[model samples]
Target chain A: MCVLCGGFVVQEHWTEGRGSTGAASVTVGGGASRERQRDRRDRTAMANRILACYGLKLEDWNGSKYIVRDVKGSSEIVHDLGALWPAVEKLIKKTADPLDPALIGRLQQQQQQQQSGRP
Target chain B: MAANVKIPVIILSGFLGSGKTSLLTRALKQPQLANSAIIVNEFGRMGLDHHLLSRVEERTLLVGGGCVCCSMREDLVNACMELLEDMQRGAKPRVDRIIVETTGLADPSPIWFTVLRHPVLQHHFHVESVLVTVDAVNGMLHLDSHDESIKQISAADRVIVTKTDIADGEEIERLRRRIGQLNPAAEVELTDSEDTKSARFFADNPDSVRSPRTRCAMAAADGGREGRSAEDGRNGSGGHTDATHSVSIRFDRPLDWHAFGLWLSMLLHARGTDILRVKGLLDLGGEGPVSLNGVQHIIHPPEHLDGWPDGRRTSTIVFIMKKVQPQQVTSSLLAFQHMLGAVPYVLETDLQFPY
Candidate 1:
């Protein structure tokens, strides 16, 4: 389960759809098109916000494949919900900066300065 | 001011099997690009062909049938700087232009940012344009299923549709229309077509590429649409829900730069990941026109032009975003402008009336 959104936890190798190997197979469930749309929007928003924390973006394509692109590097296609975490982890490991901790602090300081109307 | 004599750097990007290598191979045969340097970024460990490599020196290799090609051994800045260093040390031939061909799955924006932000590189080089190659046979499918393809198309200054001979004419036409909808300002040309010669790809000046005629056509297209001024609302029906789209905004009068800057910074901060590319020419009051370029979270420092490229002085901004609505961007910008106490001279009614 997602801690922030209480969404269903993704299972490993959970292939549930067809068309194109390595395409994401996770489907959004529930009745009514409006509800389904709303659910998807909410889920995407949540996923995007969480992914930003790790410097990744989740792009859904063809309602079948989830492309996780590194904001600073390459991208990987996630075929199932279970595979998403591992892909993201691999990307983070591949692109992580050694000075990330200091970089985050510097960024926070800059944001605070900007908010306070300082140069 | 002497540093202003910068070599134009063109970015060549495309998805895997989009024929970028083939296009480059053909283009290098031209006399215009003979003295040019190429930085090739290949993904994975497999290297380029051995026959294509003719050992010119340790740092630079002369391709058998083409111009100088250097495999990008490090980050873009380092690679470019190394080339410059080689030139300074008289170890490399004098080159007029540089071309950086990114990996198939790479995003072009970061490379653009690197060129713009690096002090040494920016002094010696300028980003001329972003050229993207799309495979005509598999482009529609790739555009529908790959966000990378969408971003590449959106970020392109020129979209080259390759493999047209193999694909059906109807499929090619459909792909062309989709490209137009995604980036009305992009100059789309078929690779196999007679008009789109290899030498002419990056031959024109940047200002000429985004000419007034292209902007007028884009304005006309957006004007023909209903219920929106900047948005292209193409529904994502069928099985695809997250459709990549573009929004073009035009202002009749000059805008307050401070207000526009704030609004853009906020938008990028909030949804930079979704925004594949943002390119615009802004009319700052009393300051002439300035050009803005951004990709993902990185925004290049604005470049100020001496005067307008064409007769029209209108400010035009094109945003290529994924999953972000046009209304959201327009409304936010309008709201910010209002909060900043900057009243736009032209009204929505004026846009409709056109007189």
Candidate 2:
């Protein structure tokens, strides 16, 4: 399991045994299964969990190749396993807009005033 | 740009306390490297004070006669650009070679990308080699614990094992073997040896190194399926859950270039971060032999060698990766080749088999 993200890390070994060509296959996680239904379920579950964590939703899509619409109505494709993290990060950034310096300073002053009053 | 006049730059990288500075100090003293410019990155803890004891200027020092040492103030590209400008303005001494010594925990790929891919730098500078200093006494422990050390060893063209005087002979041998496993193409030299010369660090011909076959042969003899974990048997050291591992694949016949390229592109796209280094000598049907070198996601344009390094004309590729299994790489290549209908050889019984 990845500690940073609460995703289950799977190590699936797919071996291609041929006569003495001596090839090896190793994959970390994602899209290794040949069963389309299972692959779809796994990818959707992972994506939905990531989206929920960032308070977003998948509005629409055309199969797994492309994401037609998200909560923001953006048309984008989740190309491969590697693209998942970047997509999540983008969604998080969009949701949690950077706080202004003045606003941050105001919040800090208010907290200090409240603490002083309690004392 | 004048032809054959680019300044050769060597990137000296190692983990903290790996004796990179000591090696540089010795190398700078050599008469052959007198006119060399050394760009040393200042470590937060050490602060380059030892190197700055004899300063010619604020951030620059003249060490060992004519060698100029400057502290890297900003990004490597800017530092190198400034050095070049200084030379042009006659502000700094003229130099034939430049050595960029990275911080202990630095990743060499970015520096390499800067040198090789930058438009201006590429035109004026050529990568001479990547020289890594590995401490013989604590090298194995460091490799087991630190990802930086693994990347340092993996990306090296030449590895200088220092502090061998204090390390156990058997332990040193073990470390040497492990280093070979991590990077088979690199030439390993002991710094403690009397015959070891500073000039040898600068002397490297990518073509002269032994073929991947010689290294892969050992793995192939073991049937290539068994994976050896670097963490086994060592106690009290940091765990190697994310340690780097190596895989060597050999093809008996020529490969389809287009098919191989497609597979490699897809693979890098998917697992580029995990892949530290990929070096291969390829046999492409009638096109002859070519060398493929890659660090992380960046694949340098392939170089065509005059002939095979060894008599063996087979295609062999060695991949050093972190948290990646060797079996997955080999099978994926074979699968891709099979899909493209470009499988090199076929077995008599299994018509669909891809070899």
The DockQ scores of all candidates, in the order shown, are: 0.02, 0.02
TM-score of 2: 0.60
Stretches of candidate 2 exceeding 4 Å from the true structure: A1-119, B1-4, B43-74, B88-94, B193-196, B203-238, B241-243, B286-288, B339-355
Chain A alone, TM-score per model: 0.47, 0.39
Over 4 Å off, model 1? A1-119, B1-4, B43-73, B193-196, B205-241, B306-310, B339-355
| TM-score for candidate 1, residues paired by index | 0.60
All candidates' lDDT scores? 0.57, 0.56
Candidate 2, residues B1-355, lDDT tens digits: the string is: 3313667778889999998877777665556666677677664424334322122221322112211111122366677788788888999766767777878887776666566655577677866668899999888888888878888887887788998988989888878767766776566788863433665575333343322322323222232233333442232123562356666667766765544553564355446677787776677664446666767765655555555544556677777777676655654554344323344321111001234
lDDT of 1: 0.57
Estimate the TM-score of every prediction.
0.60, 0.60
Query: What pairs collide in candidate 2?
Result: A24-B327, A24-B330, A24-B331, A25-B327, A25-B328, A25-B331, A26-B327, A26-B328, A26-B329
- Write one digit per residue (lDDT tens) for candidate 1, span A69-114: 9867699886534345556657777422212344334434544555
Alpha carbon deviation, residue B168, candidate 2 (Å): 2.2
* Model 2, docking class: incorrect
